[model samples]
Target chain A: MRVRVFADADWPQVWQIVHEVVRAQETFPYDPAMTDGQARDAWIEAPPGLTVVAVDRDRVVGTAKMGPNRSGPGAHVSTASFMVAAADRGRGVGTALLDFAVGWAKAEGYAAMQFNAVVETNRSAVELYRRHGFEVVGTVPRSFAHPTLGRVGLHVMYREF
Target chain B: MRVRVFADADWPQVWQIVHEVVRAQETFPYDPAMTDGQARDAWIEAPPGLTVVAVDRDRVVGTAKMGPNRSGPGAHVSTASFMVAAADRGRGVGTALLDFAVGWAKAEGYAAMQFNAVVETNRSAVELYRRHGFEVVGTVPRSFAHPTLGRVGLHVMYREF
Candidate 1:
């Protein structure tokens, strides 16, 4: 699979992945009922921030966005979020997207990469980041309400590059 | 000292405290030169969020804002930020504001409170939070650029009530 800059035509596929993730209420912090426009504004970032997709045989299977975690002085540290098609799990789409995001941030002069709210219940994601050199910097207890598991912690993961 | 709901008339004083903190660039993540309007827009909370002031004999000595850190699924977890006049530090102004914020979040039925980017070098603020039951859940290495200290970690502090 190859990661590439996203295009306008990629929105339909991107939305599919985002929709699946949000509706599950299992990982992301997004509003499950977020409208198309709202999702676009939230997920498809503008310049200085990047949004990209992973393609396998011309099919978009995963997407990621990266940019400064905060404005002003904190802007030197980059933060990112990702999503993969439900059926695309374990296919390395997420890995490809993560590799691209880290590389992009490093080339852009970011001192670090942070994941602000990785739900602890999202074991696969937590493991994936660990394999990629990310560490669990902290966990906010009972900060996330899992649809079926009640409240859970959210892990703040980080990697210095 | 009394903690009270913020009002339009509080803007000038609020700006004073915010200006001192931002200009110091030793604590908050805001731009040192952030304009009055920009700071106002960034610090003031709208609906679904709350902003308040700590009044000392009719003077606004401190301010705090609390709200959901994310939308939808993660909205149950609350987050807050605080600022006290540089001259007002160590006078129990920050303590009062923290107490008020914690109580406000509890009253609003939030599941927890999280501070996303607390500069590690800001020892006083970190200690203040610890005194009020917050724990250092995680720290992102080199996530903040201290004006004179080069780079420093940003702490993610959390508390559940």
Candidate 2:
């Protein structure tokens, strides 16, 4: 799979992935009832930030949105979110997207990258980030409500460039 | 000191406090170069959230803004920020504002209050939150840039109602 800048045409596929992930109520803490416009506004980064898609043979397999974690002094550190198509799980689309995001942030001169909330129950995502040199800096206990696990901690993952 | 809903008349005093705190660059991570309108937009809460000021004999001594930490599923947890005039530091203005914010969040049916970022170098602020039952759930290392102290951790403080 190859990652590329997201285009206007990619919204439908991106929204589908976002909707499914949000509705699953497992990984992301996003509102499941989020409207299309709300999702678009949230996912599509403006100006200094960016959105990208991973494609495999003309099909969008995963997507990521990245930008500064906060404004002013905190902007030196960046943050990002990713989602892979459920059916394309083991094909490394997520990895490709992550690689692209890291590269983009480094190129953009970010001192570090921080993921504010990674559901603790999402083992695969945790492992994936760890494998890429990210560390669980801290976990806020009982912050995320996992559908099956009830309330679970949310991991704050970090990686310095 | 008495806490009351923020009014248009209070903006001048509120802006002065906000400007001093942000410019100090030792506590809040807000942009020091933030314009008056930008500061207003960031400090003022719309609709679901509320902003209040601490009045001591007709003088606004402190201010606080509270709202949901995140939208949708995460909205159950509330977040807030406080600012007290430098000259009013030892007089318990911060404590009064904290008390008011906590009561407001509980009355609004929030399950908990989470502070996303509290500079570790800001000892008084940290101690005040701790006294009010907020625990430092996690500290992200070297996330904040302190002008004289170099880099310091930012604490994620939380309190469940």
Candidate 3:
């Protein structure tokens, strides 16, 4: 499946994916109090530059955003977050979205890419990032509060793309 | 320098140290609108089982907390953050706090440590974590808006400790 940048009209499908994903806040570390508008700000509302989505067979299956990882003279690296429809897992959708992110960050001249908070137990995502050459840099040690699990750890990984 | 865990009575000095280092939203990822109480919850209200502080000569130079990174089966790992008074930089205060977190996580049975939402622009802090054997694992590009820079990226890093 080919992936491309999301347009304004594509938000409906993105919202659907987000809506379902929000129900899994126990794992995502997103505000469990998140509403549509908040999701809009989180996923849409590209700040100056850097927002995109992934589509497959005419449906938006995944979404991700990328931009300057920091500011001041240190703002050379880029960062991104990705989401894929539950049904779309194991189809390489996430890799494609990450691929898009890497290309975009490189084109933007970012020195590297960083992911700030990945649930530590999300082993598959961690493995996928490791397969892509990202490294586990630093950890916050018990950050996000999962709904069902009570508490868990998060991972921060990065790569130069 | 040594790290210790204490209650709110220990907070005045802790806040003093943290405020000295993390005053500007530009320095930390916290909201510019965050109040003292909110920041306290963000730092103090862990999953009921983790908190800490760094003291140099019985005067708190820095403070931090650790606990389950998330809930459910994912709770095997821990996440933490540290804030050192600007005056205490380079005195091994941060290293001490981190060491405490590492030992505490190990003793508490966490499998790893993760950092969620590390500001990509915070080079010194990032580098410190790197020197401590952490790796940059994931990035949420431009997830935050800075007062001066408009938008900045967030980095997610982790280590097994």
Candidate 4:
């Protein structure tokens, strides 16, 4: 899979990936009733951020975004969010997206990285990040109410990459 | 120190902490120019949540808020925001606040806990949570724009306890 910063032309494909992945109401914390415009704003907002797409055989299969976690005095560290098409999980799409994020962060002079809310229910994503050096620094208990799982814990992970 | 739910009686002290700690322009992602009323509304907004203050000898030294990180279907796991007065730093007030939050969560039947947007520059806060068994799971690049730190990484940490 080849990953690259998304171009204007890539928005449609990338948006499709985000829509499908988020529509599940499982991985993302967004409102289940989120519209296309709002989702777009949520994913593609502000400055100094990377909205990238993963391509396989000229088809977009995954998407991710990387940007400064915050501004001013604590700007050195960066953060990222990743998503793989439901049909493409366990096939290395997440790993590739993470690799892109980490490489970009390190070269960009970020001192660390942080994830704010990872659904505790998503064990695969948690394991992937843990294997990649991230850790559960804190937990927001019952922050997300899962449809099937009921109340699920959201994991807050971080690493000094 | 006696820790209990915050009431109208604690507003003065709450404002003092917010003015002193949150006013630093580095510890939070919010703009330093926010007014007192706005901060209060953001922190203490009504039922189904609790705001607590730790009082030492009748003076407030620390404060925290516990509530749903997300509303509706995602409101099971509770999220908390804490602030300890700089003058009160080694007093274990933060631990008390955390303990209160965790116990409250456990009693409330949450499966896990997640801390969203933990500032990377806040080493003491991070270490405190780490000692409490929270792990950093994912990092968001440029999640918040800090006043002095330029860009800050937001850490998403979680613990299942």
**Which wins on lDDT, candidate 2 or candidate 3?**
2
True contacts kept of each: 0.91, 0.58, 0.08, 0.26
Clash totals, every prediction: 3, 0, 54, 78
Candidate 1: regions farther than 4 A off: none
lDDT of model 2, residue B2: 96
Candidate 3 lDDT over A24-98, as tens digits, reads 864476654567888888877466446677777788888887776544433666778888889998999889988
DockQ score of each predicted structure, in the order shown: 0.76, 0.67, 0.10, 0.19
Question: Candidate 4 lDDT (Cα, whole model)?
Answer: 0.79
- Scored on chain A only, each candidate's TM-score is 0.98, 0.98, 0.92, 0.95
lDDT of 4 by residue, B1-161 (tens): 98988889889889888777666865666546668997798778476778899999999899998866664456555678899998999879999999999898888876566776687778888999899988876556555566666666667777777
lDDT of 2 by residue, A6-115 (tens): 99999999999999989998888789999999999999999699999999888998999999897766778889999998999987887888899999999999999999
Worst 10 residues of 2 chain A by lDDT: A138-147
- Which sections of candidate 3 miss by over 4 Å? A45-48, B1-161
Measured against the true structure, the TM-scores of the candidates, in listed sequence, are: 0.94, 0.96, 0.55, 0.61
lDDT of 1 by residue, B81-161 (tens): 999998898999889989988998899998788899899999999999999998988888787878999788889888878
Per-residue lDDT, model 3, residue B106, is: 87
Model 3 lDDT tens row, B13-74: 87676555454665565544555776677678555457787766778788888887654445
Docking class of 2: medium
